[model samples]
Target: MNKDSLNTDYLWFLIIKSLIMKNVDLIFNEKQESTLFGYVMKETENKDKIWFWVTIAMTFFIMLLFALPTIIIDPYFHYHEPLTDYGYTFYRQRYSNDGIVRHFDYDAYIVGTSMTENFKASEASEIFGYNFIKVPYSGGYYKELDHLIKRSFSSDNDIKMVIRCLDYTLLARDKDAEHEEKDTLHPQFKAPEYMVNANPFDDIKYVLNKTILFNETYSTYLNIRNEVPTTNFDSYSNWCSAFTFGRETVLGEYTHTDDVQPEKEFTQDDYEMIKGNVEQNVIATINEHPDTTFYLFFSPYSICYWDTAHSNGTVKWNIEAERTAIELLLECPNAKLYSFTNDFDLTCNLDNYKDQVHYGEWVNSDILVRMKNGENMLTKENYKEYLDEIEEFYSNYDYSTFAVGNEEQ
Candidate 1:
């Protein structure tokens, strides 16, 4: 061996020694041998434990941020105390109806489609001697009304009167017919069962929804400022005006430039079925609550509606159904049947209507006044006379002259 060979041997020995020391460091300590397999194992376990705790902390923080406030300050669940009176503009009626009936302090309920929305609850309350809450569901069917009536009766609130504005189109629909598609009622008009049962899923849905959250926040601001949406009818303040037009403008808008056919014909059986459902649902509801005063009135649609009905050959059927409904309702001692359908002075004037079917709130206010005054009511003795007059007016009305212009008219 030479000096060069000795140097190479020493270099190899140093390298080998360094490798051995590095391997020794990977071994577990004698005391830690039972707990940890090696240094890498211990480090990996520690990292996983830290990650698990961090993830848990993040989840709890998220829950606190979103879930906690929504649960505690539930705006949709009206039963929860310190409720923010967000008004009907932001109000999700499907979720809030039962809650309002259950929690709000009101004695009379104004039930109907959008027509009744214009009927001032304050005015009705004054005349009927009851505190009133307007629960108008747009395009509501009799079944919807029945559900509301039952819920109103079921609630702890003192429900003395139910002022229902009956829409003739709804009366003509089948008993099982829903206002919405798929035979499913809108969430705003669903039965109180889910709400009454305190469904947590429903609560969470409204809580986390972006639209609902926005509305709630906006409503809170409105409530704080005691402000109402421009479109809203303030029953407390007697502000019932709902349209932008003066009487002249409304009439001009509805004045048709051409004759149009907007009516659909129904078979005799269909008419009968509609009448039967009305009796079964409406009349039965009236009879059920003898202690409650039921003011059922036909909402006055425009003359165009009647013209369409007559042209479609369904006017007679509609009249027959109306007659039957009136007769049945008259039988119920608790019911008072009013008819605004033949109010030619109002219905004939196109200016009074926003559309063919929807009249302004002034007409609604007039109807409420008439109901309180016992005017325009169709009793069994005079319903025939009223119906005959309506039929005659519908028959003689020159729909062709009025229909020649606007398709909407």
Candidate 2:
């Protein structure tokens, strides 16, 4: 065909297709209008009474079939056990309980990743004469820690003490793009939407579906219910087991499986930065509530993993961190290091660790004992001893055979 003739034909085809699409839309609209008119006429003839009742019945049926099951079944299938537990409480409160609002008057808080979850607030309260709450959210790093400290310490509730079981990697300041991309991933870590300073739009998905999606709302309720009940020390250990193994089986998600070894000491500048944060943020937080007495700790791990970290140059960082942490406490005049790591015999047990770093609730009970006996209650002699042990641990296990601020042999 000639080029001019082919161009004309294509133009004609485009015009024809546009007209056909318009005609099809017009026909569909007309059919919809006719169907609506018929329904309206029928309803008018019946005085609209029958139609109203039928509509109500259908609506109720749909809610019962769809909404109820979404509130109940979907979370179980999704392996959101925590969500299920919260939903269960919410339903019970909404339907059955007297509907009392849960209030916060906590005197103590247990803060950390899953490693800290086993410590029961009640036990801490009983031991320390302070009411305790576990703000246990796994994957919470230093940024989250800063937020929680600011929010909780500043609240009306007089927080008497903060027992922090910090993960060692929290010192890593390499920020990921996910920190901005996935804000909705951790609501507990973020400031509340209603707060003027916090941008609610940051967690758009949570505000939308977490609030509007009625099914997911039920899961939140279950999470609240699960939190109220205090599991025994043994139950806490079993829960750790579930967290370690059951999570993989149920959700096919890994938690705290990463192996880390500290290989190099942070420079004096880095050491100062970390120390400054712990002092300004962590220690200053306790000081905000004059009534509160802080006891800081580093949780115990297996000797093998501990040794590996020590060999990897973790010992120097750990010592510097702890030393700075102590200096910050000294500034407080009332604060102390409840030194579980300083006194424990890590060489005795491989059974202590569930993995590279975390362990079960057995340590929680031991901690309670240590706190009670004042074994962890720091003295100058004991403080010197703790520093000595760090050096000894490094000398014995450190593979690089290097010292902080010293050249390799």
Candidate 3:
């Protein structure tokens, strides 16, 4: 370790390395004249040389190692997770060996935003007596739902019903709201004309989020743990039970919990865009599927938040939007509004909500009860019965005023 001794040792190492390098250099020069080396050098000069090709292959292999599992394996195992549970960027359509999308042979499909995504298809099937599958995307803007409906049905003929969810907040006509509407695997598969005709900006954002950068930057394992298989009512019940209170046997396909909360404040633009998109799309869907039965529901929010915060403007905007949607639905002849706004006495109750807008366990069940009863509204007393079974589940809820009629809650 002494400096003089180290110097001597380093000198000897350098001498050995130099000798090795000189020998290698001599071999390289000799090989330069050999036929194999000449051919290799020429190949390297060409764009399709084995070395260049191999690099490209290795690069793609590395990308596949990271990207494929994130898109295919994770979603495959976690498809049952609510659409709202995962961020919008995670939507993907996996390809089969024959390049076809492998979908559940559902006789019915739920087409809406995240609100409808959390709904268990099995539960819908149980209520309607038809196999249900969810074809949901984030934001569930009306136009997007229409496109997805077209895509899902066009892909299969056995599809019978389209279950769509409407929300008051989803009706804002914010011009600045940003939406992603791309089909990342479009190049690999034959997509519907609507996809090909979508806005270019939305398309780029979707491709970037789903394929290029989203998975690589986000935590996948965390997401998978939250999503699971929802093939039947019992399985859905089990999934929801795991995240809810007490030991209970799951009897349905959806987990009963009020965990998801949308904490981000809406931008002025988001308000306008959402409202505009929903209005336009609802009208379009009604026109296109004139014979299809459209069941629309404005999903319930936490009573405490809505009562304490939502104002008259918000209520008016939402109600007007719903009326507009209803007008469009009327055009379809078979469409009907199962407006939870009027049915759930607590539809405007913000305290029963888990967050600014999400409802509690008991509240969600009531909505399920309403969904189960397509033609009749659940009386306030009946909704109270489910609350009674849960034993003051909303007792600790924040006592806030939601100005749904005149002022902000």
Candidate 4:
């Protein structure tokens, strides 16, 4: 309880503090000096070596985890055994179409935008007496169409007929011009220079992508279980009437309705651009392939579309462009022109279309039947008359009935 007792206590406290400081310094110094210390530490050279191998093994395992599905499912159709049944549900058409062209022994190709998607390959084969494959791009432009047709013709198999649905919008641009920024063709279809160059290393993009990996995995599972649908028609079998009003529809489900109207207009300059595109892409391709029979049909967009065209002031120019296109095709001995655009009963009937532009599959099938039967084949003789009739029909037709809120009236 004196000054000497207080000094003794202070000395004991200093000694304990010194020991605690020393321990703290050791821990801090070890952390600062060691490369791997906090969670995983390698104090000895042997431990360092073990850690390095472990890291390498872990990386290799991760890489394999990503790469195995790419190899097994082979979504790109890059490798695997014959009859492996590569499913098409999740397959990207721009990439898959090349493989289909290269591997499938089809003589004829049905190539176009989504309008051609519903055209049955089986019916075409049966009627045309050639093996058929439908290569459709949902919103394809002429450039995409040209690339697909060129690829089909360049294949090893015997090149027969090519049935193409001419999309009028595609003709709005110059054939050689690139797509507009807002409407660019899918990257899968755009350049394909990677595929052409056969760059194996670039495939790492596909192999590592989570989306591609999941789709390929799902597709492989479907294939293994034999639950995969036939890829011949692609997703067309799922397409139904799309006019179900407010009802939700999946692929293959469409509806029939008589209520629709046009809301677009066109100009003289638009016609000029369309003409140039048709000349550069369509006519050029037809002229290039003299030996191949080209059956080109203008898509039967519904009357609502024509109303929009008329509203846009593009109706007359549109007819003129068609006449020009038909004349050009007729010049080519092997090219057959079919003018379904003038089929009023088919085009005017709202029941035949899922939208302003997309017609039902039955319309597509009937076109094929007519083509096979040689009916409605547009010759130089009938071409003028057909255009006249179409013009008159458009002039006389009243679009007020299709007004958005006039269904009851």
lDDT of each: 0.65, 0.50, 0.45, 0.66
Each candidate: RMSD: 16.2, 14.7, 13.9, 15.2
Better of 1 and 3 by TM-score: 1
Candidate 2 residue lDDT tens string, 69-151? 34343322221223324333222111111111112345667666666767776677777776676654455555555455566
Ranking by lDDT: 4, 1, 2, 3
**Model 1, residue 369: displacement in angstroms?**
1.5
Q: Please give the TM-score that candidate 3 achieves against the real structure.
A: 0.51
Question: At residue 66, what lDDT does model 3 achieve?
Answer: 42
Q: Against the hidden reference, what TM-scores do the models get? A: 0.72, 0.58, 0.51, 0.71
Of candidate 2, the 10-residue stretch with the lowest lDDT total is: 92-101
Compared with the true structure, what per-residue lDDT tens digits does model 4 show for residues 150-203?
766656787878898887666666657753333122533353444332467876
Q: Candidate 1 — which residues are off by over 4 angstroms?
A: 1-65, 81-92, 181-201, 217-268, 405-409
Off by over 4 Å in 2: 1-103, 171-207, 210-212, 219-238, 243-266, 344-347, 397-409
**Ten residues in sequence with the least summed lDDT for candidate 3:** 93-102
Cand. 2 Cα-lDDT: 0.50
Superposed Cα deviation of residue 232, candidate 2 (Å): 11
Model 1, residue 161: C-alpha shift (Å): 0.4
Please give the clash total of every predicted structure, in order.
Answer: 11, 12, 42, 10
